[model samples]
Target chain A: MRTIRVELGERSYPIHIGSGLLKNIGAYCQEAGFALRSPLLVVSDSTVAPLYLPQVEEALRSQGYQVVTHIFPAGEASKSLAVYEDVMTTAIQGGLDRHSAILALGGGVVGDLAGYVAATYMRGIGFMQIPTTILAHDSSVGGKVAVNHPLAKNMIGAFYQPAMVVYDLDTLLTLPPRQVSSGLAEAIKHGLITDEVFAYWCREHAEELLALDLEALGYALELGCSIKAKVVGNDERENGLRAVLNLGHTIGHAIEAVGGYGVFLHGEAIAIGMAGSALLAAKLGRDRAIYEETVSMLTALSLPIRLPEQYSEDDLMEAMKHDKKFKEGKMTFIIPEAIGSVSIVNDIDEQLVREVLAQLKKEDNPW
Target chain B: MRTIRVELGERSYPIHIGSGLLKNIGAYCQEAGFALRSPLLVVSDSTVAPLYLPQVEEALRSQGYQVVTHIFPAGEASKSLAVYEDVMTTAIQGGLDRHSAILALGGGVVGDLAGYVAATYMRGIGFMQIPTTILAHDSSVGGKVAVNHPLAKNMIGAFYQPAMVVYDLDTLLTLPPRQVSSGLAEAIKHGLITDEVFAYWCREHAEELLALDLEALGYALELGCSIKAKVVGNDERENGLRAVLNLGHTIGHAIEAVGGYGVFLHGEAIAIGMAGSALLAAKLGRDRAIYEETVSMLTALSLPIRLPEQYSEDDLMEAMKHDKKFKEGKMTFIIPEAIGSVSIVNDIDEQLVREVLAQLKKEDNPW
Candidate 1:
């Protein structure tokens, strides 16, 4: 098993990446100072619970853990306050204690919502992540768990770290093809911000990865998680260099909000967002080829490059104002200086944004 | 103004304590980089809204802030998830943004509930505290903001820090006698844990304080807030040393929980809780005299030493299980080692708690 430590001092935890990691989660909890006999709360969604919840529960129970599972419907809708209330009530009824760690066994939706529940439940309980989809490889390790508010996505959440995140590669075998491509958006972000070699690797292995090449996929997952762990350790609250991780997220979140949260997958929205940001970068005097290259790479992965129907430039601008990055009533965008470089720019001209949005709007094709 | 910094690195904020400080809040926000022209969302309760919200709004408006006020019914009952939802929706309608700072202008109930709203609104927005009651002297300083769940108090909340805390002593002049005494419980606790001089002062001015003696009360308020500031700075997440501040709160919370939250003022419940903890300490052979002294001092201040006749010891124990301090189903107690000394003791004997409860059962004539 390969391990990457997210160094957040007392809040720090490890992400174990490999096959068979799920079967040994109880031992990890034991080593993390949790009681082996303590009850484990397995939190998941309707989509993933049926496939992995039983195996995760069995894995813990085999090592003497008394497991109780709670499943919510999968989608952005499940990240509401009502759902948070229900999940918390269930946790209390199941007799979860500090020693009774929460095992989040699902994709990004379940990971974000359940991680938030664990963070606030009893002022936080121990939690371990058994990421089932490729999308979770980034989210599970970063500790940025949140539920979406009506006006915004991830508008209600905390920067809470998990005790351990077990990213079992074997679990990804069951992830849908579209989900894998969606996740590549984040992996692409890590490459664009810090690692050029990883960017080239992604460029080379796009097809192999889409074909479910296990070794290539495992390397990509570990690399993404390791980079995330380092960034989170250095800047957990995303104040400084950590904001670099939000390369495409600013415009991406606006897309998600404008389209309404559940209309597009998180990574799918980000794919188009990256395109918009890249276009903005080219307009701001960054290399034109880098923008074209980014679009081509995303398109080759079969990720959507078109903005959603019914979303206008004005709607995107309005949605961007709601972003946490907005300060002094002006939206900030993270634009690339080049393919392997980016910066958080707050002084971008609004007219420039309008021009880029106008270009994105005038595209002939929807996808 | 005397400033106390609750230093949690980047999340650190100033606690400005002095008389007439509310008038300068606009200046402080501007200097802190927040635009004073943005609409201010003032969240308070009905009891405090009529009393202080006008002055607060007047001060902000005079400085060109577009102030919008929201008032919920004043009481512990208002600290529900329903109330929080209402506040969030109102904030959305009022155009509150990441730039807009929420001024929580009331006692503990307002501070806890509003702070939780600020913590989750748009995934966290900047908020300030204009504590109008003595009980707020404690709630406003620590970043531990939360609302009570049906089965538990503070079960649903997060450790969200504020931009600044404005403790204007003039606001405390209109505070009721019961609120004054409630605030004193924490003042007494600070003395018990770290400041012996404050403890002695509590004993000396018990009568004056109960009568709202401004000089004595202000001194006590400053001392308590300063001590809490020091502890919170050192342990933002309550990992170790910060638990000292919760002296008597573990059992005090249980008592309040069993009594249905609003029946007993928080300070009244804590006063009795201190008596119970002192008795427990005496039984444990740490400092019997200190326990007796605390009980005597509480009696002198006219604080209740008995739990409400309705709640049985079993009900208190059941409520204690929901406390955040419960690790693996075992409730931990913050017991005194001696006067001016405290420690978290996990191995408290249940029979001893029953004995303490039995003492409350006795219908006594006079001390």
Candidate 2:
């Protein structure tokens, strides 16, 4: 078992990573200071709920903890205000008190939705992240819980830290190949942003991670969470330094919105956006090797490096304008300085971005 | 102008209380570091919009701050998630960025809804409170922003502070007599919980306050804000001491809920609850003078001391049970120790609460 603490002062909590942690969830709750007298709410999605809800409930109940479970449809569409309201209704009906805690027991979508419920329910309550998918390795740790707006993603949310995050690696054994690749995109992003050795390590061990090798996967998740925890701890509110974490998110969010949030997973969209950022970096006369290396890393993990040809550059640009990162008709991009470091470059030219989009659409891989 | 600072470390902000502060709002925004380049959002209600929105817009525009205004129908009914979503849409449509500021330009409902919008929009933005009602004197300061759920009031919300609170005494001149009494209910609540002298002064100058004497009103508001700021500063999240601020809110909220939130102004219901708290104190073997003094204080300001005959004790109890303050099938009451101090009493007998309700319904007030 490996534990990484997100040092957020009084709001700080730990991320526990290991095998069979699901069976020991009750003990973790006890260790985390959750009250047994208060009813605990377990929020999961349909896909993950059917497979693991019973075990989580049994574990919690065995410790004399009363449990209430709410399961929503499993998809990014579930990350909407409507689903949030439904979950909140279930919480109110379940008679959960301030002392009661909410445990999010699925992937990124479940984690984001449930964390948001905890953020606003009774003006914030105790929240624990139990990430089941590899994509959640990034989202569950940062305290950026939100439900997407109709016009944009994560438009309505809060920076609410969780009490703890319980990551049971055993759950990842069930993920399909596409999901595995999507999740690893974010893990690889962590390596690309701040850890040079780890970035190369990820590309080197791509097969092991995709094969659900618990030792390799666990190490990657821990490193990814640690990188995220450090960035979040230093700048919880994203005043300046925290914007570095949004390296690929500016264009990444635009891709998700243009694709209607269904065609591509969040990590997949971000993977392409990271590729775009590298391309943008080269366009701005940075090291050309940055673009080659980023694409190489993403491709090794079987992550998508190109925007689908069907997604027009104009639509993507329109979507970018609606993003939270777009300010005063100017785009903010987190461009890679090298493989392991990035810089937040604001006021990037629109034409340059369009040129990169055009380059990404070519039939043959072009450098 | 008298300014009282709510000392919340980095989130600390000033409460500016004086006559005609609205015209100087642009300057306050500048002082508070609001950016001219980022568009500002002024959220008002139908009632307050026509009265003051133009002036606020002109004031901001004159200072080179681009302004976007959103007005919802004025009432407690507007504090719903649906309205919150609408405001968020306007925020997104208006191109409100992270640097943009949301100025709440009405009473508690507007402050709460707008503050909640600012709290969650793009995962939180800058917020300012421009209070137009006396009741807002209490609501705007403590940063307890929320939108109500169908099941309960303020069930969904966050503890988000504003950059500054601008209280213009001039706006109160337009308030109807009933609204005046309603607003004073909260101002007087601030006095009742902490300051014996201020509580007595509220009764002594009830005529001037109701008549809208700027001098008396400013002094009263400054004192009330100071008392509230001191309490909220010590405990921001209501971990302990901040619960004292809910001295009259528990029963007050129940009364408001039972009355369907439309029947009684929040302050009026809270006035009765304050009287009830005093009566409960006497029933708990405290000083009988506490009950007499409470009734005298409320009556002096034309505030209701008794629950209407139309309301059933059973319905009120049911409403109380749904209150956020009610925990684990136990009623938590903030019982008055004297005229100016209170204690958080948990696990109070339900029967005693019923007895007080029954006594409150009597034609002749009984201690």
Number of the top candidate by lDDT?
2
Predicted structure 2: lDDT: 0.91
Runs with alpha carbons beyond 4 Å of true place in candidate 1: A361-367, B1-14, B31-40, B64-68, B91-100, B122-125, B193-197, B285-292, B365-367
Which tens-of-lDDT digit does each residue in B67-93 have in candidate 1? 878899999988888898888878766
Worst 10 residues of 2 chain B by lDDT: B358-367
Fraction of native contacts under 8 Å reproduced by each candidate: 0.56, 0.70
Q: What TM-score would every model get versus the actual structure?
A: 0.92, 0.99
User: Each model's DockQ?
Assistant: 0.53, 0.79
In candidate 2, the residue pairs with backbone N, CA or C atoms under 3 Å apart (3 or more residues apart, or in different chains) clash, namely none
lDDT of 2 by residue, A256-362 (tens): 99888878888888998999899889888899998888888899999988877898999999888789898866788898998999988888999999988888777
TM value for model 1: 0.92
Tally clashes: model 1.
1
